[model samples]
Target: MRRALPLPLGLLAALGTPLPSLAAPSVELGQVLITDEAQDELIDAGERLRETPGASNLVDMQRVGQGRVASNQDVLAYQPGVFAQSAGNDGIKLSIRGSGINRAPGAHGSGVYTMFDGLPLTGPGGTPYELFEPLWLSRAELLRGANGFDQGSLALGGAINYVTHTGYDAAPLQVRYEAGSRGYQRRHVSSGQVLGNLDYYVALTDAEYDGYQKHSSGSAKGFAANVGYRFNPNLETRFYLRYRETENELAGRLTKAQIKHHPRAANAAYLARDDSRPQPGSTWVGNKTTFFLDDDSRLEAGLVYHDFPMDLREGPMRLKVAYTDVSGTLNYLRRDTLFGHQSKTTLGWRTTKHLPNSGASQFVRNGDEFGPRSRDFSYQGSDTVLHAGNDLELAPDLWLTTGLAMIYTRRESAVSYPADGGKVSLHDWDYAPRLGLRYDIAPQLQVYGNLSRSVEPPHPWSLIWSSTVATQPIELENQTATTLELGARGDSVLGRWDLAWYYAQVRHELLAVEIVAGLPAKEANASPTVHQGIEAGLDSTLWERPGNGKLSLRQAYTFSDFHYRDDDRFGDNRLPGIPMHYYQGELRYDWPSGFYAGVNTQIASKVQVDYANSYHADAYALLGARLGWDSPKQDWQTWLDLRNLTDKRYAATVTPGYDDAGQDVARSTPGEGFAAYLGVSYSLR
Candidate 1:
């Protein structure tokens, strides 16, 4: 048990002490009073200042609560270059810098990485990252590109850090239930408490939706819990756990003819082949557990374990060290997929041979143990990766972060028929070194830059399975890149603004190429490629009236050109699916009484979807509105939010392929529209 400091002393002590005033030379003040408590406050403030060194965006808890983000991807959509595509709740696909858009069968890799309280939640198969429920998070910080070295893990794109709520203060309880269009409904319950030296928060959310396409209805349920204890003011420990289960029967790719017939028509055959669930009736489960320790505000350590099991797909095992204040982290991951098949028959082949059965019987019994060619087979494989690194602060303004990661992978797949047997195993290695610097130009402004290296491992789909084919594990060639960036961030009348420019050159880059429908052409490390971009953002209040009202604005924009240097297959083609431009804007008005209204808008330019640059997805925009009241004098709060106010038709997915009828077989799902939600909450302080 820990003692709670007296109210006034506790807060003041955490802020710092007031210096003694100098008295007249002749009549010096009797001894200036400086309490022991004041000394502790100074130390706390000093530690906090040293722990975090960079500008960060902290979304208001209230604003987050009002936004109905179905998945972690949704949480990133408003940010430049970040987008999440979900057929429905729990079925989410995310892309950052155009990664993961072209996931082929059997491959396990997603470029972006995610962590909670400094614990990586990314899986070995990589495609299916555990969709962290934002409800349990206190706040999140995004460190774009290599600037995210503090996350302790290795990622080339960027890092999303979710920090769970903890520490002393008040206890709050909130429960919300909302229903909307498309048969969408959800319920969330969350609570937080600070007792003695321990603090914690927990939340649970259950959501269901009857999607835009027939047979696409589904339900998603999840639970997340966090617990932390402060061992005096210098030591603390915390635990985070999450579990999610989802069932979806959804439509997949469709030919242009099918789309022309009816955009929302149900293609049962296509629906049955949803890649995420090969079987018509299937379920997917994901679980994550992480433990972390914080010491003296200068050292942090964490361990994370994740499991993703499915009824019809491979399951992956992932572990990581996502936290570090002094030294960095090490990560290890393994993934495997296995299935069982069985065949049964009542009649024997001998009967068919002796009795001279009908033509149908003869044809059916031709190859048999019950039937000619009756076969049952399954395949299994494992991918192992070990990544270790550290962020070393060599000087006050200069820091060097470096690490090495190695991966060993194996595949043993068999068809019951001895005629077809194959095995493949390969080892791959990558060394990453990162250097970053920040020079304070002034007390209010700073200049920063970084150069780093990264790699993307091969996916399971890269293995060949044809009996006649001398199948081979695609040669493991490390995909490496060098990045150079410069940025400036500070506070001003424009509110808080961040501007940056970056240029990256990559060798042996992994680029996805669409060979034909439902099949991969091959895996290859292409010629050098390059990506250059500029990112800018602003957040601030435009006007404010004392005790009356205020108007605020928030905006972000990204401009980039990502392309392959030269290639025969897709010569000088701009990498597909990554838009050249994207933007987000929000306007809000708040009254003294807690009444508020806001409008949020998001836009993305047209993007190519294939290596040949033959297919494209149209540009789109979405708008949302919110009305709420949070009274300062009351403990209760209520709000209403409406999304996709226009009910506009939009596409969320598109595949690059021509159908049997010689028509484009690309299918796009419409974004939800005119959806509204209402909820009320109360807290006891």
Candidate 2:
């Protein structure tokens, strides 16, 4: 038996060292300690997400807005244990602590859940790609692992919620534009207003990019709006609307040799077929109502409807899909004193109904010409979940947290093609339980630990499209895991730091593997596996003065150890895809005069490409820098961002595959070369 390593106390001690006190109060500290009405009104919307007893992070858009905000990578760069690699302007491969590490580009069963505000972005079919714009968000909250139980997440990777700006928190008027290398350009306009008892916010954005690789161009246009009515101080309701249309050319992947010699070239096969995503779009509307039962209690309910249409042209196939989803949630929260200690309890229920219509056609060599129909399918799926949680202050400095979630899912599908008429159905019931404890060592320090279980049902689409059973059956077992985690987070005189260590034993873990060189990856259940990792983040103030400004260093490091457990064939080989070590760091300086400059770098270790652990992607490091100015009036801001300063040629992401007798395959997407972006924004209160 392999013994687990002990937590790194020395590393934590080093990061917890004390530093000189600032002459002025730190906004960071104020965020944690201040609870006055004025301070509460000024708090970022994501603050509540950070109060979880497990690993969680809040990204304030104000900080990220200083640089290029192009893709998910830009928004999640400083977060530990999570990796979002850009495959193209509109494609990002996301993984968290080995979750979804085996999935290929465009695949969506990653166990990670995504949301917009409180609305589910990952529908019942489990797809959340090419659906978001960073500029539209006010902040984002990442709750790792079972910490996301509050959001009805049933995945090992947890959930991320993107919170948008509201009339009360947004600028009265704003305009922003960005232009960058590779024909990148974006423009956005927004307005917010409040009248008597009503408030409204609206935004429109258009973006275009001719990617670094050939045939990788993409464009998008989006509109988002929301209106709120304050029935009274105790009750309020808001309605939201969102629409987006996107189109992109697919570049496909390349082999090691090709990546080294012609990294900017698109796959020959993809180019021949003119592979692309044509006018993929979505429309969504939703409403949320909240009622304050009392000072310590509240009730909230919300409902959302989404209509999505997508078209894709692969080498010789064209697939079109129409998806509709209706989802809703009801939640209640209460706080009371239990045995003289503070206590809080929450109850929530969520449900979603998904309807999807899909069809595929075979195409000839003639571009945009289709031959005979290949497959057609219609699917109906529904998921209902009930969850309850409680937090009890066991003592003056100790708290206990517990939660339970029960989920029921059902899927029914009908297929028609080649005279093969059939119907398939699958149903599953799953439960997740979590227990955690947290101790406050000081006003600014905390340590927490949790033991939890997670369960993820296969996506409805995966059950029909990626089945690997000999009979091609649609029934698949749920992916389940039991995890144990320990962590510490605090702000010291030196800086703010968050560190965590976790180990998980997983059964029926979902695996995506490419059996053929040119076909899409297929999904299957793998043997038992082990996932363990260390996630650490630090923000240190190296220098500070009230009038002179400040110099700060931010760093995030993730160490992942994931492998099959004595598998029948692979025999404990490392799972392919994610690197064992990844690190990102930045040194930034800000002046009282509203000027700021920062240099950042990212480094990753070599990653295994095949289950045999024989083929691998070479390690690479990227450096970048940004300089910006913010007017004291907070009305105008501008910045220049430089990326890939060294112009390193490397794979930004890779698709997992089985061993092919030691031969390398074309399954890697090359990283972008040196590029620069300039952005300017103006806002009025």
Candidate 3:
């Protein structure tokens, strides 16, 4: 028999409390609000987020922009349970909660779902990399595990939503410029304005870098814009458009010996072929509408269309793909009093259709001529999801939340090359369930626990491609896991802290194995495995003097313990690619005059690099510092950032291998050395 818990009243009290009086009337983008209902809606939305019963975090982009803003790693450095490593200027590898931990370099599959302003960035085929720019976002929301049910995401890694600034949140005019080491330069310009019921915002950016490693360089250009109209205080609609073009050279990986002696050298094979990502680009358009039904209910609908073109050269292979994606979502949220207690319910539906017009793979013997057509195909994929969840108050301070999701996916492809006519189609149906309880111990403290199931299907590329050994196709079974989690968050005299512990039993876990040196890894289902970890974060003010200055400390730590569970082959062997211990911290001092300085460090324990558990990468620690001045009037700001101050030589990331008994191959990408950057920004309102 099973029993359900009641919803907690602490969240309702916290959100319903009256706010303090403001010092002055707020004016945004020189526009005076015509009604107070809009402001109330915003506040209600924020309160609802705070009431969630699981691990969730909101990152303020303004705080992240205070230092180096060049890469995603810089932006997500303080996020617990998230690991982001830079492969180059335009490429980044990201994983959360052991999700996609064994993915190969440049692979098109990810277990984590990513979105921007309520629009899906990951297509139905699960290929999502390269769609983030911190400069264009106002905030980021991270929902871990089952906490993302409201977003209709069933991935083990959970979901991330990047929210962009609107016309009301932007300045009338803004300009920014940055110059850094290795011939790096960036420039951005933006403008926002409002006329009658219409509002609009636009931004343009250009960047170039002579990368840290030899033969590694890149350039990118982007444009983003949004236009909106307010039909009434209860209804509004917005349209978004974005375009970007990028070209980058590959430096490739290096051996441990080479990393130690000549860390900046490019791989010989990569240099021979001049491997590069040439003219990779995308265009996106989306529309979102929201309707507020009374004070207790709201509905949202959105649609997005994306066009992507990719061209790449890797060693002796040339690949080209023309990809298009269409997605739509509908969500309804309602809050009411159930049996004289507060109750909330959410229902969401999402669908995505992906089409690849022509995907071609060719072998090239010379510089400009294609040698042989290895593969050519056209594909269509679709994904549909329905999710519903409810939170009901059972007692004064306790709450119970339950949710379920049903997912259906299909893939169809026709092969036109290889002189053999063939057709392939696959379909799958999966269900995910979640249950959780929350209790409020105090006004500022809370504790929660949850149990959930997650499912992930194989990407189309993985299903169609072949393993390096060529013994069989690379089509893998869907990965599934059952997880249990407990967490606590609070603010006290000591500081603000958020901590969580989770354990998962995974079946048919996807594992990538490097069978051939200097080639893409092969995907396969591994034996039963266990993933457990601890995520902790703390932010505290050590000392403060009224009207003088203050000192603060911020820290985040992650402990990952992933291994096989009494397996037949590699019995209890630890999984590869992730370090057992990873930590990041910062100490800063600020003055009343708007001057601040901070020192930050990152540390990682030795990591296993192969499934055999016989080979490991040495541990490393890096230190960096930054000093900046921010005007109190928010008119001007400048920063000087210094990274890798000690110029340490270490691997930024390592690829996983099956066994390293007699293999001596390069499998690591070297970290950057000492570098400096200076950035300046000015805005007019």
Candidate 4:
């Protein structure tokens, strides 16, 4: 049976709650079906909200029906101030608070940190992993700014944690299948049960898709299992493991003309001197082991290995091992990314059919390494981080949290262009510090703030390996950002509201700059930068009637100003690709007959193209809804999701030549028009 909830505006106002600047309605009231873990972390609905120490948020699985998220990019599309952009239609790069803008294919260097379960996914050198697939994410938590003090690392933008579901709490046996736009299909199965003192979960997922462009066929398969044993009321142990495989053909990006003629043409020739069909694909496998000592202490470690057998691409193979210890009072991490032994290459495509497609394809290397018979190259790095914190009860209702972290990183790059050539090596060291705190005010209100620092070490690519700088040893470049964050959160008659403001001062912002007249370029700290933003959110149950569940609403809004300080070329430019205004809202109503209806929307303000800042993509909004029914007696549910309910044709990307060239250079990937998906789920005991 459903429970009653507080009314959105009426209840909140009646409780004398000061509502944040809300852009939409609040969640409707009713019995909040919270998970066990969530219940343990939060004090109560009315207690002061503290998100740092053991903070996490769960996206209700029952709310998201069977619609396909074309790519992992859609997972956080509704997040405030977050922008997910695709160079083509298949690959995506996420920008948070102006971080990760320069991230491209094979590019290494991430301002943000990404993790799965408790293990780090990004390599030791902060190289972000490609979004393999979004198959088994049970819940996702985005810890930003000082909110991530407990998890020690040189995190600038923030950290994203994806928790996969386990079988213990899942249905005994469940299966699902779905297909969608551009020849896409998927199959998934999961199972879980409890026995005495043990619980277990296992899941399998497979997906294949012929993307919106040429040669854009991607197929992936994954399997995962987790087992937990509760020794007693004070201690619990759990084991988790996952394996994934993928084979994708690169059709690459298309130009404006190609997109207009064939929306799904992956083989379109857009770059005259470019070749993208090098039979490109990669295989990666990862495994993790974790043990929990107590509710506040955990020890986790993992290993990741990847190999790439490319036709024309020449980069590096990856091997990484990481260990992390998290205690209520202290945290520690040791991570490393190493290049393995291997020397090989494949033939370059000779036909125009294999030409790479892109709005700006000149950045891609056109010629292949012809004389490179045998080459030995090694690039390795290790990051050691330590943090210590303590919680002090200042007053009955107020609490203060103090913490500090020290990070030490070492990097080495050795290279020999040809077989037995004279080898050269470059090395460097970096150090960073971290700090933060939270405070509770009135009965239901809390204020938290933090001042921390972060840094990005130089990548192996910056150590001078290209023929353009064969003899010039490039210097290591590092960046430091000082960030300040303040926020207030509470639950009142108005529901749950959170408001925050953040500002950052960055020094030595890294960039690839042309240093010498006759030489190519070197990675260098271009200049300083400043980023500031304001955000507000609300969740509430608007109304409720006995047995009719309740009407719930959730919404968030952000206004950000990201720009650079010093240096030439659009100084103080509104950091390209970041939307100044972003908003998301959802309204849902559930009933006894298992009948449910919901409406969701995402809005983005106009954003500038690349660094030129001469061109910009227009503002756009997409609204969607879902209607479904479930059987009360039978374990069955079905739903239809209508995405992009309003037909709106908008270009997803546009890149103009420097100095406002003549060509439009727009490669608009079509946002899905109004489409409906019908899905069904069943369980077998």
Candidate 5:
């Protein structure tokens, strides 16, 4: 924290303040104010992100904690161009710009690169959900679409970086407890401190719940820690560690009628077999080192190790999957003067690969009893990319940006248990290039445009599971797209607003369809497709009184139009998972005494349930309210959250089938009904 000394009488007199009494001249000084390191860091991060010529969002976890911070779904609310919904467990369906929209929620999710504290968390297989405890985060940054090029993420959905709290932003000791309907409970304890040039932070958390649907309970426990040291003004390093384990029971999907009448009933098959997914454990360890070459240049290097193993007991089979990945990254950043103009340049290299022992085993199951082994398979994959980018100031208040990247990808999958097991191995090279420009129309307004390309590789494990024959592996090509985007963001009379429009010409687009009720879906390369969307967000201070309170409104809306350009069978049919229109808004009133109340709503259009558009999941609107109080000294907090106030029964998520023929298939997960929760926390600073 920084400070300023009290004003001297002489300085006040020089500033033309009149003295009331010469014998006893009095001076009145206001209370000392200290800035929160975390808040300053968030502002600096947002300013840095605004330099990019694309859309992005910075999420403050502290604000999100006022209500409920259950999962990523809660953490990512009110973010335009992003769709995240829970699948009745830790698994959530997350998509950006129609990426990975159809696949069912599972142990691993795709189409985006995820990170924790700037270290790799997404690898060749995909992103795991076990270690994402929302309370461990200080903030989150989302780079949508190709805006993540600087982070070495070459995916359709770009990247998400979760930043954890450090000693500078944490209290010395803190404890929290939460309880609510359906027997939900959670507890947490954490501590952080700074000593000389060294700092450390650690936290422990656990949660359990009796879910809304029968046989859908779940529990989790986790810990996160980090330590950092500054050797000198020019050198620094930090180490990070995270470990978590979770077990959740499964309730199979239900038909439209079932959700309307018996929303809390589990599917008969799921109840009979007691289906569940229990993650044995997940761990991530990493270190990052930085070298300040000079005032205008720097270099950073990082290495990470990740291990996530799963013990899945669902459907008619039990699968034990072992996944481990290792990654390395290096980046160089510098500024220079070229042709008498200011310029900034960056060069980076990164790679991620699966370990030798990454594989899975399957066994037959009946009524919670295991049978003989059925199949054994191993997955192998690696990704390497070298990229360079530059931004040049062509004129005052104007910038030109350009970048290119070369990528190498390898995938291999083999069935090793059965005799003469089939195998598939493929390697390919691809490239992406980008160009963009931005100009400051005024200090409070700016306009930007970018033309870029994106490439996404199929997961190695998908090759084995997507096959028609049980013992064979299939080969598929990489998905690629060329996109054009135009956008602007700035302050206006109404409030802070952002609006963007983008269109992509996708080639060999990857699509997944459910072939069976309880098995991995089949992924195939589509002929061609078109993806277009509009994203808008606004935050306004509706009313304010200096000594009383303030009223504010925040809103986000997305309009998506994604479809097959020309297919022999589907014929320009719309995608089946995401809705065409989505919106979320919150109207809140905050009092100067640390009390606040808010009402929020979420609305979405009908969603198609099949590729043929034979049927749909009906549109729905949800209403909720939150009331909370934060102590003036920031030592304590308490809140009450009410959800689904009208007790509306609707499908919260959908897993599309190939062709239901207009039948209301068992393909939707019911949303939670009316519920209430209470939480409180105390901190000793």
Candidate 6:
């Protein structure tokens, strides 16, 4: 075989794929060998998302802090197409692919499009999860659909940035603690530094729990900070701050026979209406700047400010909302040589607005006393975007991607209380476009394809809370999709892999039901819906023993298939609230003296809950474990986390129901049983 030659046509279609990592690395003996590492910003963002052609994910909070990193369901555990569940506190229920499937699980969170260090934090009355602390992350980036079109996110679940911690990765001082089971605890502290061209970071956190149903207790507090400067070698700037506060106590949904025999029971009209939710604080501030315009061009700018407020005491209504927002961004980047190959470009613009005192003020409660002010509203909105993108190097490793976007929207709702009460204004314009292709076919294989479009709109308090006739306001539309994707990523001998498949064609699709039964959940507009999927991932190391310990495995899988393409009474049936098969896994062991151990699993698939598919919510499996230590100069760390051992009794989430004509009724949110956790951290580098 000393005479091998000829191969192209995308490396002969990746050697006729039969799926061996996807179907398909190392260097030595040279003084020049570098894969990635500029102080490792998550391996330079996984080498800049492998030059994205479609689909992307990267989350690292230093291996998720070894374990027990609380909320956002432990920082999106095992990610692969994401689902994120937890309704027993830090409000979870996120979705991707089937985008905001049936929206429920704490206040607003819909069709994903959030960001922090990369600017904007979703506005127009949605995506508010008490400042999302997550230990003030150091990484998290997901691009997904339309590959986020250079970050001006066209919704339908795309774009999530969340990157904090500065001072080049932070570690000047730190402290941490955690405790668990049904009465958990957590606290943390931090600091960071760097001097010459300035830099800084800060953090603080708090938590409390006493929940596993019955009144489902909760509490939280937070803080985060940042600063940066560089004023030379092409300029730079940064600034940010955050604040938060929260309180929760509302345990209402349940029944699959109360999650198979009273799995922590608590709904009897929520114990005669004692439900709660309190949040008197939430804030964010931001800034970003950069400029180079030389070594191949660059420019960037951003600004943001946000405030969130709410105090809905749960049922007999005592609302008290008010929000504020403002945002702006600009970007430009370039690298050229087009005709003869090698090019890259991006241009963007963004906007968000809502102010003029944003909305709400209803009131009327009974046993806990509160009367006057029955209604008064006001909520306006705005969103603007303009985008452009390009990449080309069309042969020799092949790459081509293109994009376009244009959007402008405005929504206004008004009901200056008990008088005439009605006003709705709207304005719109939309467009999105993209195309892609990628092929490396060597360098451990890569392949990709895409075609996209996405759009979503309808918040502004969901047009008077999904109105039926409560002061008018209800005409919702604008939710579109048009996707198609194919993907692959590799590294053979069974080591690393990622695979994807997608198909969508949704046109009005905005679902959400729960007709009535203790409030909330009413969104609409659904007619032609179909969203298909499959996403797979693996990261294995199987075994190794050079200095005495190694074995690893990681996995994730998702396969949803939302329905309805023939509906006039639920004809094709199926679209009810995720779960068409989902899985997660982890198995690990590592020691070269840093110590580690793990075992984990999660499986789901039996979730219909209603849309005339007449109730469902059974299948489940969960088990977990972890043990850890890291001190090989990592300064200090510790962990031991376990959950739902064999005490299964599941149903982690579901907030559906439009026709429970078959009645088993309540609506589910149980999942949590045998738990344990412990953690510690110390640093000073």
- Candidate 6: Cα lDDT at 302: 93
Q: TM-score rank, highest first?
A: 5, 2, 3, 4, 1, 6
lDDT of 3 at 409: 82
TM per candidate: 0.73, 0.94, 0.92, 0.76, 0.94, 0.34
lDDT, model 3, position 673:
94
For model 6, residues 203-249, the per-residue Cα lDDT tens digits are 98999998998888989988898899998989889899999898998
Estimate the lDDT of model 2. Answer: 0.80
Q: Assess the local accuracy of residue 490 in candidate 6 as a C-alpha lDDT between 0 and 100.
A: 69
> Which regions in candidate 3 have their CA more than 4 angstroms from the true location?
1-46, 356-358, 363-369, 467-474, 662-664
* Candidate 2, 441-520: lDDT as tens digits: 76566788999999877766666667553223366678899999998877766577788889999999978788786566
Count of clashing residue pairs in every prediction: 8, 1, 9, 22, 0, 1
Weakest ten-residue segment in model 6 by summed lDDT: 25-34
List the lowest-lDDT window of 10 residues for candidate 3.
22-31
Candidate 5 or 3, higher TM-score: 5
Full-model lDDT, candidate 1: 0.51
Q: Which pairs of residues collide in model 1?
A: 13-41, 106-461, 107-460, 107-461, 367-371, 367-372, 368-371, 368-372
Please list the Cα RMSD from the true structure of every candidate, rounded to 1 decimal place: 15.7, 3.3, 6.0, 10.9, 9.4, 25.1
TM-score of 3: 0.92
List model 3 lDDT by residue over 1-685, tens digit each.
1121221112122222222221110011110121243344344444555567777666666677776677677767877777777876756667778887777545564778778887787766675455556688766777887677788888888888877777777777889999999988989899877878998889988889999889899988888899999999899999999888888888888878888889999999888778887757788889999999989999999999988777877667787877788999999999999989889999999988885563445455454455775767665778888999999888988889999999998766555666444555778898999899988766667788999998877666565553442222334677899999998776655456667789999999977777676566677778899988877766666799989888877777777888999888788988988777788887888888888998999888777778888777779999999899888777788899998999998888878888887354677788899999999988785
Better of 4 and 6 by lDDT: 6
lDDT of each: 0.51, 0.80, 0.76, 0.52, 0.84, 0.81
Q: Rank the candidate models, highest lDDT first.
A: 5, 6, 2, 3, 4, 1
Estimate, for each residue in 490-531, the C-alpha lDDT of model 4 and write its tens digit: 676657766667888988765543222112234566567787
TM-score for candidate 4, residues paired by index:
0.76
